[model samples]
Target: MNAVAGAVQALLVIGGAPLLTGLMRQVRARLEGRAGAGIAQPWRDLRKQFLHKETVRPRGTSEVFRIAPLVLVATSLVVAVVVPFVTTGSAIPPAADLFAVVALLTLGTVALALAGLDTGTAFGGMGASREMTIVALVEPTLLVAIFALSVRVGSTNLSSIVSSTVHDPSRVISPASLLAAVALVVVIIAETGRLPVDNPSTHLELTMVHEAMILEYAGPDLALVELASAMRLSVFLGLLANLFLPWGVATSPDPLSLLIGTGAIVLKVGLLGVALAVGEVFLAKLRLFRVPELLAGSFLLSLLAVASSFFLA
Candidate 1:
């Protein structure tokens, strides 16, 4: 039953990811006073990409380049299944360890970086270098933030943390919780290639981070990469929503409860998408050099959260 429930939730996340991406694009377009593509546009785009007859592999690229997208999407699906998207209880409880979740995400990033380097293109190398630098900074802060929350629950398991916080909302009000939330929000924006870190909509060669790595990909490869990117974004946003505001997640295995939990997560993630769009509209991307500073600030916040958790406990 746990495996069944997890499979269902993973399917929901993978299927709905492109919709979330489309919705965010539409919201951003409207905010900028332009007519937006329909919320189904990402799905249309993916279909179009898939319909293309061939994928052009760049010269000197290896099997790693061809397989990176699959690795990325697979790792994200694993995260979706283990992250308690619609329930406080996990299908695979041991997989819900916060460190394991972070490691899986890091593995995906590392695979992409290797793929980028495999292309031997200047843009690819540059993007991969920048990405690795960012990840190196982001991962520790991410772990520290999770550590802050875990301290309160006495376990690093995501389901355990969510259950503890949900059962006692007072934990949500603590200094550590607030600090960790802020740090995680910063990490999310950076990790997801959102504005003030990296812009998802731009292909400007000089400014592109994520886009640069995928410039050589086309057709089915591009579709898979794009879908993986969307799913990754959705997973991060869903984690943020359910972890911080776990109000509507199911604690039981009943059908009705799972149905309600599904609806609640969709609403939560949708509202978060809207908020992100609005925030992006008001903020400009930080300078490439300045990005390290911003991440450093997040690291400081995470460290403070850890300190607060220990001292205030």
Candidate 2:
């Protein structure tokens, strides 16, 4: 039953990720007073990329460039199956440790960074360098922020963390939890290349981060990379939702529970995506030099969360 729940959870994320992206775009469009493309636009884009476009391999690129998309999507799929999105129990219990999950995400980041360098383009190299710097800060904050939660729960497994929260709702409002939540939100924004840290829509040579890295990709390869990006957004949103607001996640693998769990997660992540889009409307990307300061602030919050967890207990 745990395996069945994991399969359903994975399908939910893969199928809904594109829709989530489209929804966010539509929300931003509405707020910007434009009649936006419908929520199916991303799906249409992906279909066109996969079926009508030809894969282009740039000159002087290596296998890393060719394989990075696969690696990124593969790791996301693994996390989707192992993490507690719909169910508190995972198909692979041992693999759901918080450190393991964080490591998987970092591995995907490294693969994409290496692929960017493999392209040998000036923009690709610049983006890769910038991305690694962000990763160095973001990853540690992610670990420490979640570590604050684990300190109280007494386990590093994501399932255990969620389950503990589910059974003890009060923990959600604790000083440590609130601090960790803020820290994690910043980490997600930075890691996902959202506004104030990086702009997903921008292609300006001097400011683009994630886009510059993928500028050399086209056709099927581009589709995979885009799909993986959407998946990662959904995965991060799901983690944020489940880790902090895990009320509706299934503690058992019964059919009814699984159904509720699916709906709950979808609703939670959808709301988060909309909120993020709306928030981005008012935010301009921060200067490149100031990004480190923003990330440093998040790191400080995480440290406070950890300290509060120990001292306040």
Best by TM-score: 2
The 10-residue segment of model 1 with minimum total lDDT is: 1-10
* Model 2 Cα shift for residue 131 (angstroms): 0.3
Candidate 2 residues 56-137, lDDT tens each? 9998888999999999999999999999998889899998998999999999999999999998889999999999999999
Q: Give the total clashing residue pairs for model 2.
A: 0
Q: Which candidate's lDDT is highest? A: 2
* Cand. 1 Cα-lDDT: 0.91
RMSD of 1: 0.9
Off by over 4 Å in 2: none
Model 2 scores a C-alpha lDDT of 0.94
Please report, in order, the local distance difference test score of every candidate based on alpha carbons: 0.91, 0.94
lDDT of 1 by residue, 1-313 (tens): 4666688789888899999999999998998999999899999989999895478899889999999998998999999998888888888999999999999999999888899999999999999999998999999999999899999788999999999988998888899999999999999999989999999989898999999899998989889999999988888889888778898888888888888888999999999988998899999999999999999999999999999999998
